[model samples]
Target: MQGVEFAKDLIQKEIRGLELLFQSLDEDEKFNEALQVMSNVKGKVIVTAVGKSGHVGKKIAASLASTGTPSFFIHSTEGVHGDLGMVEQEDVVIMISNSGETLEVLNLLPTLKKIGVTTISITRDKESTLAQASDIALSYTYEEEADHLNLAPTTSSTICLVIGDALACALSNKKDFTKEDFHLYHPGGSLGRNLST
Candidate 1:
């Protein structure tokens, strides 16, 4: 395979997915609801997922925390094995699942409901079980995956990361987060150096 040719196709697919995601967000009022939950939460934002979504979830949690939202990530499997203790009734939990029916993610809902936390689910299926179960559902549909095989999580995870960034930015705006607040949480990196100066 010509590497450049393959890369161009993949890049085009990713761009297309982002376009669709943007359109979906414009039409979805639930995005605003999720933002309200994150903005008003007196507790940390807890993000959970498994597999590729888990990796994306970690970044989402980190972005939220650094932007002054106070957040963290927990593997759904571990949440079941006692990590859920870290979550609180006041916390807002966000779950990521490409298919929206991931068993590991779904398995946590019953307990989360009992714990009385506000739950949000990000998935491609708005009507999925996980979406239906959560208090707020953020869903988007991408036409296809980036690779020729069309079997990887590339586009899906990219879109999820973008969604997380949007949420973090929204909350940051709502809270009037400034460079000073950002420096407080991110004081050791080049980004911190730039913000501090």
Candidate 2:
């Protein structure tokens, strides 16, 4: 299965990139600050993305919310319509874009900037427009599995999802978020059944 092999190699490359990123953050101060910000959050973690990234953003928002970080997903394309009202100055925005140049997301960058919302961008390109706009840029770039034929998103999306998981767990640990806290937010699925009394 050549396709399977390709997938495995892609996964390995992504894992390597993530390993490097985690190793580079050996000093806990930056991470600690992010955690503290999450713990003291007065509003929700608003996750935004376009296309495939939007799918990942929705899942990430759920993960963070269940882990005790209040979060919600917003479609970037809809931001200008009426969804923009959902964002508050007190909230932190997590923007997801594989190329970091997503048109829908870029279109709303000016508005977000004007409104004074703190943003964190997750992208494969560290120097992308979205990354530059963000207060904190989290890189998910994979140098090895470079699929320039639009297939790069498969690996890149997984990388972004994993990074989101890492952020959620790290913040949960910092806030001492417990299983009970997770259960409170996710009380309808199979996970809720397992966590229920």
- TM-scores for all candidates: the values are 0.98, 0.85
Candidate 1 lDDT score relative to the true structure: 0.94
User: Taking the tens digit of each residue's C-alpha lDDT, what string does model 2 give over 78-178?
Assistant: 99788998988888888899888898988878878877877888787878998888887776546554353546566677777887898899888888888
The pairs that clash in candidate 1 are none
How would you encode candidate 1's per-residue C-alpha lDDT over 1-197 as one tens digit per residue? Answer: 56998899899999999999988777889999999988999999999999999999999999999999999999999999999999999999999999999999999998999999999999999989999999999999999999888999999999999999999999999999998988998899799788877
Off by over 4 Å in 2: 1-7, 27-33, 146-150
List RMSD in Å for every model shown.
0.9, 2.6
C-alpha lDDT of all candidate models, in order: 0.94, 0.80
- Cα deviation of 171 in candidate 1 (Å)? 0.5
Evaluate residue 163 in candidate 2 and report its C-alpha lDDT on the 0 to 100 scale.
Answer: 77
Scored by lDDT, the top model is 1
